[model samples]
Target chain A: MTQVAQAMRDKTAVCGVGLTLGNFQDKSALALSVEAYDLALEDAGLERKDVDGLIQLSFGNDYDRFLEAVGTDVRYAYQGWSHGRFIAPMLQQAAMVVASGMAKAVAIVHGRRRRAFGQLADTEMWRQGLGPHGESPAYGAMGPVFGAAIAAQRYFHMYGGSGDDLAPIAMAFRKHAQLNPLACRTSPMTREDYLNSRWIVEPLRLFDCCQNNDGGACLIITSAERARDCKKPPVYISGMQGVHAGPQFHNLTLPGLGVAQQEVFNYRPQKEDLYAYQMAGVTQKDIDFLITYDAFSPLVLFGLERFGFCGPGEAKDFIKDGRIELGGELPINTSGGLLSEGHVVGWNLFIEAIRQLRHECGPRQVKDAEVCQYGSFLGETVIFRR
Target chain B: MEPSYKVVEEKTGRYLPVIYPEELPFWEGARKHEIILQRCNSCAKSWYPIGPACPHCFSMSFKWDRMSGRGTLHNYVVFHKPWTKWFESKVPYAVVQIQLEEGPRLTTNFLDCAVKDIKIGMPVEAVFEDITSDITLVQFRPGKK
Candidate 1:
């Protein structure tokens, strides 16, 4: 059997990545977005005028506002949102736009003031608008942690996993955070702290949740040819894909009463990651480091297993012994991840991947790094070369 | 005849399920202590949280039918922390997902058991909790063998 490759693979490259000021609150989400955009332009050695396209999630400042602030003549713009908490979908969209010749360079940006305005679910403005409207919310499944807890519980039941199994992941990220100056949680966390922390939902402790902080991130994507002329080394978008659990029902799906399946729950993302690998023309062994959408700590465990980094239920063992840490077999989340670096959705994971491939991460850099795999709700695989 | 529902403050302070026109029959059935769902006429597939189209076959033609309300508890979570003002008193309560006999999983609370003792794959049955004059929430408990 032959495998057809991803059409847009290596057609576009990420030339610039920028982030706004960290946890310190001062700027509005819009202001932070503009700041990140300016920084990204500077990093790419391109001016506002060089940006012919803009791609952003709705949470960011308006494209017209961004163009007015930067004074760039934008030829194309798109507002995208992906299922679940994935931010890489917009990056994939930007790459396609650039590859199609509709735009020379596209900037994808995301900004959120979740801190200043209070938590998204707690704020009256969002509460009234968003409401606990979903089916699960009707049954007291209001916060993301609740549903995530259920998923974690199911994983534990199926794979002989326990809260103790996730201890190493939390500790590893905390250690990684210690090395990251931009991290929100810099203080070291002991195993006792992880276990003793109050449970938000059983099997999920305080440290399992990602922090809510004020921040924004932007990435600049352009044709592979144009990226070569940029100031920073380009991290090409080799292969990227997003996969949802096939249907709305069952354990693998979100906590909603949409459908039911009789089969044993077998939810894994390895097949999707394998498809991405084939598209990138690389094997799993070629990946030097990886980053996961660590909106919640347990997700890192799921990402590891689902991405085929290890066999089912082996992720708990695979991630131990400094394996996922720097200088280990496959260093992961070199930027400290959302667990420590503050949640900018999954955008930080992509930026961290670029930084690693560019050899910009001085202390947390994975040695001799080339291929970097990123797993979100969907999986994206990119291989970088100097 | 039994009252359609009983008015009470939602324990979790979350919005009660807003019954749209398409879901009126399901709620109407809940009031009668029966589990009703949408069955696609074309594929004979049943679904919960009633909607207009069949998710399996995309068939618009369907009928609301009563389910036996028997299922196995597929998974569950016990909330040790309350997210809203309403659920503070209900802290440490459990929400269970029951894979029903008719091939649909419904999200509801566990009844007649301590949250700590509920186990996965346990056979369960649906029960109703009347929330408002027109809203009755379906919940689950250990099935009587």
Candidate 2:
């Protein structure tokens, strides 16, 4: 609707989905990055020579940092928004580059070994607004979590979702994580254990957030016809859209009531997204599984509502009733979301969606899964025509 | 219980104001502990983080305006997992996004009320916290007489 949609799917296809264990270890972002690059190339049954274009994701990545780490010469180089709202733009650019014959095959990549790399993202400049004329945070609200907390609170009020309801959503993913090899969380999560956890934000508990991990993931996109020769069946970039709204962003107008609600996150606010999902040409009912970006537990529930998988503020009921888990109506985060699987800044979640659609996920795969709709916690909705 | 803050910077000897080269008026108002916004003369649209021109009309016509800071609690949440150590204890604080009467919605911390007292559409007013002698940042508290 308000965000521009993509129109070229029959042309471009994602041929390979590659992800590393993505955890916070001694590995540097660059080393973890190389690991991710190797995985995608090998998985596609190709070599470095097969790639012509490269799209690198940067929230905090320096071009030099990535270029030196991976060590490649490319015909084209591109960057996407680091703050996460511009993923569709990144994919769209990669597709455009390849489809237009700018390059033959494009590798779009994102990764972070945050915990081992540097201090968590808190800086005076970020806390303050950008540009000298900008209005910095009042009382010095310098953390990204501040806006995140605001979004969580709004979802609770609009949906009648309480802390208890939010608790189980994380619990569900934590349970699913046990089956995952790369999952950072090994223990099971119980409701009592969740309630007993310390509070982080009002209504947000300690277990509510995602992990700081060391890993990287990449996708290789080529012409759909050429994709069959390289790797597995291609996951088409069926319907995609990303637009910047809001004054707070240098990319958008100031944060208006509309952009603040949609741009900071579209899926968190149910009212806007329920209407937007209609344009994707499929509804929640059509999706057999999901690969939601669960940076926080409440966020997972908020995503469910935004995707129209359930009614407004009804994600808790959908989750608590076991309707959102394996064999349920919507099997969410089969690869254990950011919380349990570890944060690859949403790339791993994308990998899992492809895995399910390809029926590669053994134990956690949704039975006969066909299509999926993903909620990028950092950006917009992605309906996969896998 | 009351809160305490330490001074970080001082507005000394008139360190250049946001004027001339650019309308550096944002600092001029922030110093007075009042939240200032910009309204475009062409389209009458309100904007924040103050800009060079009206985003709607692309007109540079703008002037300083003050608001009641009264508006609906558009959205909010509580973050407990510590992103940093500086904010470990304030876990239950209501981090809010308020749609100002002037039409600019901002991310802020809601104070002067119990956690449960926070609700959507509740009216709020600005309270500046002068963390530094030179800078005063605008936050919100429950509206009161």
Best by DockQ: 1
DockQ of each candidate relative to the true complex: 0.47, 0.31
User: TM-scores for all candidates?
Assistant: 0.89, 0.80
Worst 10 residues of 1 chain B by lDDT: B1-10
Q: What is the lDDT of residue A107 in candidate 1?
A: 92
List the lowest-lDDT window of 10 residues for candidate 2 chain A.
A250-259
- Candidate 1 regions exceeding 4 Å error are A1-7, A82-85, A115-135, A248-273, A380-386, B1-14
- Cα RMSDs, all models: 4.1, 6.0
Candidate 2 Cα outliers beyond 4 Å, as residue runs: A1-7, A22-24, A59-71, A115-120, A124-142, A243-283, A377-379, B1-24, B33-35, B42-47, B55-58, B68-125, B139-142
lDDT, model 2, position A307: 53
Candidate 2: docking tier:
acceptable
Query: How much DockQ does model 1 earn?
Result: 0.47
Measured by TM-score, the strongest candidate is 1
